[model samples]
Target: MRRGALRPFRSFLPGPRSMFYTTDGPHGLPHNPFMAVMVPRPIGWISSVDAAGNRNLAPFSVFNGMPCDPPVVFFGPSGQHKEGGPKDSLRNIEETGEFVCNIATWETREAMNASSALVARDVDEFELSGLTPLPSTLVKPARVAESPVHFECVHLQTVHLPSKLAGVSALVIGQVVGIHIDEGILTDGIVDMKKFRPIARLGSSDYTVVDTIFSMIRPG
Candidate 1:
């Protein structure tokens, strides 16, 4: 291609290199460099209502859903503390037993990150984070208008894990009630990641974009 400009190393480069490890240590490797270098994590902009009917929002990367009979999704919240306050999203979901998962995109990355702040329970993350709260047709909680996809869900169960030497962790499972997708993102009756440009979390303070895509067809 471009005249002798160090032809991008072909076979010399390894194929998508990564190192996987688990954290079972005290404090789980304080400030894990894993996420930052991991580069991009899918964000679950969770919305929930407190027992008092107050709303809360927060982002978590330990999130994914399964296509079981009723469609179930789950998220993990670390029992970490900042200024000795409870996580607003986890607390609200525990209190209200309901939440909405909104898929974050590049357009809404800043707003999603804002909701990650350690705000008071009563503080409305939508307002504080300057994110638009769109009413959910099938769920009590509202969805983030800036998000490209939204899944209205009801809490099914929570698996509490022992903290041992560190704070506790919780696995929250939610049953999907409704799904919503942006019209612009739907092309040829399919949602494209390139158009979605979904954002993901990396360990620490790093993040990544998700437009790069490829496909492989498995033998039927």
Candidate 2:
């Protein structure tokens, strides 16, 4: 099958009204269809330095980058930590005021997923994923040395959102202070995404990659 192609979908909704449904009540599916319905979501492989200056890494599917002038990125942890309170990434970023958003690619997808495992607060995810942590230029948080691109950012603010479960669900907005890109992925000064092959989250237990390319110019 071609890259980004979708399989035939069979819906649980009945009759012609199937197209319309409300999320306020259960749709009678095996799993909650919220995340999957959103299609491919950007993955932010975030790294931060703890109080001990130890590195922590985690993958957030609910992450995105804004095309603002100065550039900005946001990510959030959906649940409480295994040890309690916020996740290490949030705690460390709030305390240290710095973090690095590593671009997740097909090459490091396995390692990125491995880092998402819920473990103790003191656990080092870089070691858990068997990836090297490189020092960032402007941030105390380490960068994934193997990643093709990275955005070093500082905490701007965090807005708490309603959560259906225990603990806080917050959206953390960060200001991008620095960026690092591997020149090898560039083609004649243009950043070739086909070579980058960044990965994204697609439904539960599934992921997709930017392995294909197409173009569409805006109508003038």
Candidate 3:
């Protein structure tokens, strides 16, 4: 049955439409579904390495670039996995103080998703995901060769949010030391978003493509 077709019969008693946009706590039917419906969040294909030289890669929707003089980007890693403690990827970054954020495209979607597993700290996601790694000129961590854009970053800060949806969540901020854009993607010295065709996180088992785009100009 179509989801929309069956919607009118079922009613939401305590939802955004009824609560005037203010709801407390993180339980009940009013939590996850609400955030997921906000839809089409950009994916951050984060890559990091641990002190023992183990590599980690994963995808996250809680990612955004901070527009500052030198450029900074941020991604939030769940404090713990569904099974246990913090994911090794974020922990590795915390230990090494460096990471690489790769932009995921339709071409690398499968590989990006493959790395999102609950693996041990010694395991290498690059090997498990079957993606080629290119040596980074500026950072010790390697960049995914298939990705068109890569941001080599040094860890800046982490905000621990203990009472989030999960018992563990950390907002990691990084300063961009180097940026690499594939030559094929460069046009008139600008990186085209349309050409990127980046995949975005929607919800559980749902994703969106970058096909329809619009622009706006801020008033002076």
Scored by TM-score, the top model is 2
What's the residue-level lDDT of 189 in candidate 1?
Answer: 90
Clashes of each: 7, 0, 1
CA lDDT of every candidate: 0.81, 0.89, 0.83
Off by over 4 Å in 2: 1-21
* Native-to-model Cα distance after best TM-score fit, residue 29 in candidate 3, in Å: 3.7
What is every candidate's alpha-carbon RMSD to the true fold?
5.6, 5.3, 7.2
The alpha-carbon deviation from the true structure for residue 88 of candidate 1, after best TM-score superposition, in angstroms, is 2.4
- Local accuracy of candidate 3 as per-residue lDDT tens digits, 1-220: 7764745577557865653333465345534776577677889999888787777788888898978989999988875755576787677888999999999998899998898877766667889999988888777788999999999999999888665366568899999999999877767887777777899987667888788879888979
In model 1, pairs of residues that clash are: 35-202, 35-203, 36-203, 40-208, 41-200, 41-201, 42-200
Candidate rank order under lDDT: 2, 3, 1
**Model 1, 129-170: lDDT tens per residue?**
898889998777889888889999988888987755355588
In model 2, what are the clashing residue pairs, if there are any? none
**Residue 128 displacement (Å), model 3:** 1.3
Please give the lDDT score at residue 155 for candidate 2. Answer: 93
Q: Candidate 2's residue-wise lDDT over 1-220, tens digit each?
A: 7887988798676887655548666667776688888879989999998878988999999999898978999997768888889888888888988899999999998899899998887789999999998888987888999999999999999889986779879999999999999998999999999899999988868899998889988979
Error of 3 at 207 (Å): 1.2
Listed in order, each prediction's TM-score against the native is 0.81, 0.90, 0.82
The CA lDDT at 76 in model 3 is: 83
